[model samples]
Target chain A: MRMLRLLTVIMLLFSVAPTITAQETITVDFYFPTATATITNPEAGESIEAVFNRYAAAFEAANPGVQINVVYTGSYTDTRNTIQTEIAGGGAGPDVAVMLTTDLFSFIEEGTILPVQDFIDTMPDGEAYVADFFPAFLLNSLDEEGVIWSIPYQRSTPVLYYNVEQFAEAGFDAPPRNRQELAEMAQALTLPDGQRWGVWLPTEGFPIWLFSAFVIADGQHFVEESPSEVYFNTPQTREALDYIISLSRDYGVMPGGTLSWGDGPSIFTSGKASMLFHTTGSLTRILNEAPFEVGVAFLPSGTAGEDGTGYGAPTGGGNLYLFANSTPEEQAAAWAWIQFLSSPEIQSDWGAATGYVAARRSAWELDPLASLVARRPQYAVARDQLAFAQKEFSAYRTIDIQGIINSTLSGIISGATTDIEGALTTAQAQIDSLLAEYR
Target chain B: MRHHNALGSRVADAVTTLLSLLWLSPLIFAILLSFRPPNEPITNGNIFFGSTITLDNYRAAWSVAPWLTHYLNSIIFVVGVLIVQLVTVTMAGYAFARMRFRGRDTLLLIILLQLMIPSGVLIVQNFATIRTLNLFDTHIALMLPYWGSAFGLLLMRQTFREIPFELEEAARIDGASLWQVLRHVYIPLSIPAYTAFALVSISSHWNEFLWPFIVTRSESVRPLTVGLSKLVATTDVGALYNQLMAGTLLVIAPLVILFMFFQRRFIESFARSGLK
Candidate 1:
């Protein structure tokens, strides 16, 4: 009698289970990293996580039978490490992740990420969608064959942040236009007794980004379209290096040793440094924290281009990558989430909130960003500089190659090695060997 | 000679005080920074004190992550690991110290060899094992890999061997079963060793980040370290040191309180167990 009762319960459970399973929601796990913990929408006052949740909620509401599980993976490095571990463990990692734009080659080599071009090709407005993003921001997202591997989300370029009061006091009506003027103004603004320096070019953690600007302004591409090629030891690159070293050693306007990247904002805002070479992602913070009026401009150029401004910068930030490890349904859902994030409306709100440059050119025409740029024109400087911006230095085995370049730059700048050409040549050889496998 | 001895002692005390202050400087800075007003950064010549102390950093840090769930998950993870570790380590320690068996030394040597292997290299394999067991993203998955601690086993074995063998013999002669002998004789006398091992196990596991981060996906299973990491901004954007410090204080407060409450016992246990 007990066995019969158990059999009846089992039969009932089987009948009910399939109906429940039939209505199951497809979950797309989305992982992202924030620029800072305190990222808040200035208008709505929503926290970063709350903003993400709101987007997910909106997306879910639009597309029924799909759920977006947003995970706050730490920094870009941590997110990459987590995904790598997940893949190694034979588990499908997050359906989508926000990784560094330079991480494109490594992920491509790993075969873990699916090219978004596959999804784009199927869309009716694919060409228009691809054309809408800022060309500079999309530079790092494309491969040698020009296939789009990722979608630009949080993007930024390094801009010159100068103290307005200091610039005025030093009798400067405008920010420096060229390297000579930059040094002259920096020297004039500098105070004696080490009280204040003219400029603080942070060299401690990844100095390659700003340094690449110098290389670009001097009419040399830092890295070619090929993943295995880099122009680290070129004459233009050497001239850029010598000019940077002279700013500290001969000009006595910048710091002498390895200036910490983490200290740049505070050092500028605190009036310890008159000008700062830092990311536009830090624009909001610097503007908010500066007691004096903050001035933002393009980084001084080494040589003028055809457009008549030698001004150049390298775009640096994260992009949305879709993993190949998901189901077709999940991939479609993930692609939709990426589009929703990169859409003009959302991008404008995100840019105003977090100080990242909106990847889409159309996002600038939207309300919050348009009004904000109107109120504070510093926001437009990064946008204008994008015309002269180039891809951040990226190659096969990017992290290791970046490490070599960073250490070599640090060595020369810190006076550990006065042989700038020799050090860079060695670094170039090391990078070549590391990239030889890819070639 | 008496005067000279007093002078030497005075110098020693002064040196110790200097060393202690040096060691405490970073903590002092963190505490000071945590309370500093968000507008007044240390670079503004406010290294020690800002114009007005505020809880804004704490408030901002608190709102960023789910701290309550993180604390609960951390407690469950550390306590769970410690409880199982005590059982396994005690039994293994007893077997190695008192039992007679073939290849006992060889088995013990192999187990001890795990102490030399860095836990980082085992992350992928352990993660695979966890996935195979269908335990990923669970609290048990966070604690599973640490259950059998080689260091704990080795510490317990050394501690057990130092005990007088006559105590165990006497208990056995009195018709005490192996379980009774262990419970009444070995365990009670090995309180200091057990306490020492427990502190080491709990603190290390509590502060663990990589394994928990790799294994868990939900806020319900992630620990405090993972939560603390959310406060770290990317290097490009300069750090918000004030909020980072505040978040750190929140994550470490429980450990600090535990250590303070058990200060005397912890010191005595370490001393008695011959562990630094």
Candidate 2:
């Protein structure tokens, strides 16, 4: 009787399956996370969703039987978590998603993300198009064996933002070129009255600006050749950390938590901070809202004790990926959408509108916005800084590294660990333990 | 002697008003912040009593997404869950309250055990279950697990117990069947308990984030809290504070209004349950 019932079920599915496939339209859900802070700008304005919808509509017009539905996933982190849940559950996840590059390496390891090399291989101009992305961006998107898993959607490098008015008051004609001068200028501009602090840096989602500077300063490798080891407690690491710690204790230039969220970017906008180290992506937001004349410059060189050369901050942003769970037709439809968005014309427009750097070098030459930035000397600073762009080696458990750094840094700031050497040593011990687990 | 009584009454009135203000401060702050633009500098004195009221924030919040769709989805989700719960819990409560069967005690113990397990622990498994049923991205998926509440069952079972057995006997004697006895007598007598559970269920599911976030991927099925949180998390604060505040106020107002209207009944139900 059980066998008979099973035979009947199989027969029922066989009959019904063709009818389901005969449906005209294939619907793909695209989950988008809105910014955590409520954007006052209407969706009709400069938000990514507005641009996404325009592309979605255009894609639908070009492709028959393809309907793209966009849903708001809350915050960037929440979107990642939400999609992970869906994928883990073996349910319908987003066909394509915008995810932080910092997270890609780990996600791919867990078999959640589809490697894009196969998808790109089938396209006519896929190789050329893939090559258009900045070389530095490959770090986050590629595996140890160099399999491309995702395409760069948005990218940002940290730059120094200073108040022009404040700089003039401090008798500085231009932004400081190196770390020592930058610190001295901060001390010069800082007032005893609770009016302002000299410098601030956000410790939020992408604290890689500080981390990259530290790594580069210490001449430490972010990840070993095999992508297995992270050197967090090298001599350069200690020296770089000691300097940042001094900004608060020794220089008296930083008022804690003002420049940061949980120690990130709140200080600068509040007018309590004169200079902020933050992403170029934030430039648009600052321009839209800052009351003061903002000046942009490359991050100051971390004085290498002997060479006096400073390292560049790490690049941060999301990459677009096609999920493996999607149907072949749906995957093709998603590929078309991604290609349209990544086109030189579209990328340039997006880069101009939003503060994201253009992923394709070709877009920079052809984009009107790029030309506009070229005319402005300050924006040119970012273009020049791109030469030294670094991407975090999120391969060795990025979140764990951050946790160790945050706890150690928190202890240093709170004066709980008065000795930076001891605190950093403890942190390195923890990081080594984590690295050992991965081994 | 009468003067002393009057002074005590004044003190009581003063404390009540102060407490009320304290409870309402968050609402007041949200309203105040909603008027400021994102990234606009807000010094201590510029806000609070001195600032001009504005509607730009509300306009921004409305335009950010299809918030109206979110509201509709939330209503559908909350109502669907509550209605299903009303049936499932009432039936289960009736069973456990009146009916006697073999291993009944063991069965009740198993149901009670579910209450101790944290909801977070079940999320990944529950999501998998929903996927197996092919209910992902639908309102039905969001409502499925909530159809029966273990706590609601216990509360309703107790509520049914307090009613006289004579009522059930009278209905049965009048030629009413067991189903009719349950539907007509036990259900009506247990309205307060059901009302309590309804409030708890609706408010909790209304404010819930992860489950709906995980299950529903389309705006057509998204609840308001998720929509509101998405907007809250991404925007620049200085530029959009006022607008975010307005959006927040609109998102939370319905629940606040519902609470205001049902406060007395809610408290009384809880009080009764507490006694049990």
* Model 1 TM-score on a 0 to 1 scale: 0.97
**Candidate 1 docking quality: incorrect, acceptable, medium or high:** medium
Top candidate, metric DockQ = 1
Q: What TM-score describes the B chain of model 1?
A: 0.97
Tens-digit lDDT track of model 1 for B1-276: 999999999999999999999998988999999998766668545488788889988998898888999999999999999999999999999999999999999999999999999999999999999999999999999999999999999998998899899998999899999999999989999999999999999899988998998898888789999888878864656878888999999998999899999999999999999999
Instruction: Give DockQ for candidates 1 onward, in order.
Output: 0.67, 0.43
TM-score of chain B of 2: 0.88
Q: Pick the candidate with the highest lDDT.
A: 1
Question: Which regions of candidate 2 fall more than 4 Å away from where they truly are?
Answer: A1-31, A34-46, A63-71, A118-131, A204-209, A257-259, A262-267, A305-311, A327-333, A371-380, B1-18, B41-51, B170-176, B179-185, B235-241
lDDT of 1 by residue, A261-306 (tens): 8778888998889999999988887887789999998898876553
- Candidate 1's displacement at residue A106, Å, is 1.1
Q: Return the lDDT, model 1, position A201.
A: 90
